[model samples]
Target: MENRQTEQAYSLYKPLLFSLAYRMLGSVMDAEDVVQEAFFTLYKSGSDHIHNMKAYMCKIVTNRCLELLRSTSKQREVYVGTWLPEPLVTTASDETDPMQSYLQKESVTTAYLLLLQQLSYVERAVFLLREAMQYDYDEIADIVGKSSANCRQIFHRAKRSLSVKGVSDTSDRSDLEKATNLVEQFMHALTTGDAARLMKFLSIDAVLLADGGGKVKALTQPLHGHLSISESISSVLKKWPGSFTCRIAMVNGLPGIVVYKDTIMWSVFSFMIRDGRITNLYFVVNPDKLTHVQ
Candidate 1:
């Protein structure tokens, strides 16, 4: 009966726990592993004495992520090329999966996750719990084992840091529509090999960062300015002799492009739009990172 009850509890909270873990760690495999470990710990300890299973599970996952982050700090510092979070690819129509549902939320977008990466683990936990999960300061304190006042301070500090980066929690519908339309135009330009058309949609100061993890050929440094990026894209396309299929897909809850070569995911392009032009373009081509796309 206890085992059965624990299984039931796992089903009830797995989605929320996985969501929290993924947001905290920014790695799908690590998030899934942490979630499973949390539940296994819960099952072994039994849930009878637990007053709030959801909070308990969140605490476990958050603390585990903090530990993992600390251990991986050196790895990130030494990471080859530009580093990007593993892309959480989703079909535009698959709404039933809990992980998909959580990922579709703005908090899990690659851009937002990168901002969160700017924070310390404690600050990230407090800010995410307070901002993304909508937890109260007191609740956040409990999860992160900080005093309520300290959690409040951490949250404010984190918010201010993101503000310095021009982060906004709110999304405008018109802006979203414009972004989607721009992505469509960008894809069309890419397929048609129209360099001028492609350049038209990019911001003058646009930046492009590609992460290949040194496992594949990729830009070793960011490309700046519209003309540079435009020419780079044109040059790469010209070099390809074999035909590849490209399609606009919803990547990290925004309209993006996915390219497939020999039916395998070759690259994912996500953009950040500002003032009606693409301000930032993230190209993820590391094969290890594409393993989870399907």
Candidate 2:
């Protein structure tokens, strides 16, 4: 009976647990592994001594993520080119908690996740627990093995490290609609090999970062400035065999493009728009990262 109850609890909390781990580690496989390890530890320990199951599970997962961060820090140092979080195919209905739903929209963004990479493991835990999961300072302190006061200080420091000015609601329908239209125009230009049209949609200071994980053919360095990015896009189009299909999809809670060759996803392109122009373009062609996109 106890085992059955634990299994049921795991099923109920798996989505939240996975979300927390993914936000922490930025890899679906690692997050799933950490979640499984947490459950395994729970099953081995039994639940008789646990009073607050949710808090206990969260603490377990958070610690596991810290372990992963410590272990993987060196590997990321040697990663080729820019590193990007694995693109997740997210839907509004996946989250049951309204607050979590909102946080999911804001925190899973590629830019925000990149900023999180700058934080130390403890600072990351404190910030994510407080801001994304809505845990109180006391709860965060318990999870991170810090005092409530220390947790508050860490959260403030993490915010300063990321230089977060304000929270923008990316889920706003008007903003999404505008982004979708802009993405459409951008895609048309790229597909049609219209460099001038493509350049028009990009901000003057636009940058394009490609992640191939050293396993695929991609730019070894980031392309900066609209002219440079335009030339790169034009070069790719000129040599293209015209075998892929591109469509706009919701990537990281924003309008983005997915390229498909037959049934396999070939690449993902996410954009950052400001003042009706794309300020940044993230092109992810890394197969290892795209496994979860489908």
Query: What's each prediction's clash count?
Result: 0, 0
TM-score for each candidate, following the candidate numbering: 0.91, 0.89
Q: Across residues 1-294, which tens digit of lDDT does each residue of candidate 1 receive?
A: 879978887878887887788878888888889999998998798888889777888889999999999999998899999998877777757778766666555466678878878898899889888887788888888999989999999999998888435543225667667788999999888876667889999999999999999999999899999999999987787677455678888777777899876777799998887777888899999888888776
- Model 1, residue 151: what's the lDDT? 94
**Alpha-carbon lDDT of model 2:** 0.82
C-alpha local distance difference test of each model: 0.83, 0.82
Error of 1 at 14 (Å): 2.5
lDDT of 1: 0.83
Q: What does each candidate score in C-alpha RMSD?
A: 2.2, 2.8
Superposed model 1: Cα runs more than 4 Å off? 164-175
Residue-level lDDT for 157 in candidate 1:
93
Count backbone clashes in candidate 2.
Answer: 0
